[model samples]
Target: MKNYLIALLAVVTFGLASCGGGDDKAADNQEATQAVEQKADEAQQQTQEADNQANDNANQEENQEAANDQAAAGGKDGKTLFMENGCVACHKETEKSVGPSLKEITAKYGEDKAKLIEFMKGNAEAIVDPAQFATMKPNLEITKKMNDADLGALADYIMSIK
Candidate 1:
């Protein structure tokens, strides 16, 4: 009977020790899981911040483009006006296209700013490429409405190009 009691006590002690050890292991696992969740949360926050920064950069670019377009409309520079007025579509800086290149126009009319502005205003006839006058005449509708300053700037910009 004494031996039986000793055996039962040994079994109970061993079982209690194992249960305590299991509790420690479960606590360790819980801590590890919490750490993993924290890291994942941080990574998600960083990703969200990066996305917001990218969106802000895009908005800044859009705002800058809008400002540039506005400047091209009434700004002192003629290059902007020329670019915004669709002059680049038909005329290139150096190469000839549907219309005479800006260089060619500059070479022919650079000596006379008044004449160039008058031509842009549609008050003067085509002198460089009269064969394409019909094509150029239609484009003048936009040019004729420009103020004198913009025309002068455009003429100056065309002449300034090499």
Candidate 2:
């Protein structure tokens, strides 16, 4: 009877020790999982930062290109002035929109750049589409504010369209 009791006690003690060891292993596994998650989060943050940096670089390149184009145009290119002055909203190269097409204006002017400049300066009447003069009247106010050089550039760009 004594021997049997000793053997049972030994078995119980061994089982308890094994259970304690399992809890430690479980804790170690949980710590490893948390570490992996932390590493993954760090990697994701780095990737996001890289994407932001790439976007910033692209924006800088675009700004540089725009500056270079402006310089190439001698401070103000005719086409740039035209686009900036809202001419593109109405006068496309070939197709008409709210007003006459640039091609139509070019055909009417026929290298008469001075007349075109005069008209933009509001010194001359609308020869291409006199019917829509009222629609363009408000825009003339904007052009009337520009200097002769800018007006000439705008007229040159309009006349150059095929």
lDDT of 1 at 81: 84
In model 2, state the lDDT of residue 97: 84
Candidate 1 backbone collisions, by pair? none
CA-lDDT, candidates in order: 0.84, 0.84
Residue 134 lDDT, candidate 2, scale 0-100 = 90
Q: What would the per-residue lDDT of candidate 2 be over residues 1-162, giving only the tens digit for each residue?
A: 999999999999999999999999999999999999999999999999999999878965765565466567677857888788887898788998888888999999887989988898888988988887898999998889988767766776676665
Q: Number of clashes in every candidate structure?
A: 0, 0
For candidate 1, give the lDDT of residue 46. Answer: 100
Q: What's the lDDT for residue 77 in model 2?
A: 59
lDDT (0-100) at residue 28 of candidate 1?
A: 100
User: What's the lDDT for candidate 1?
Assistant: 0.84
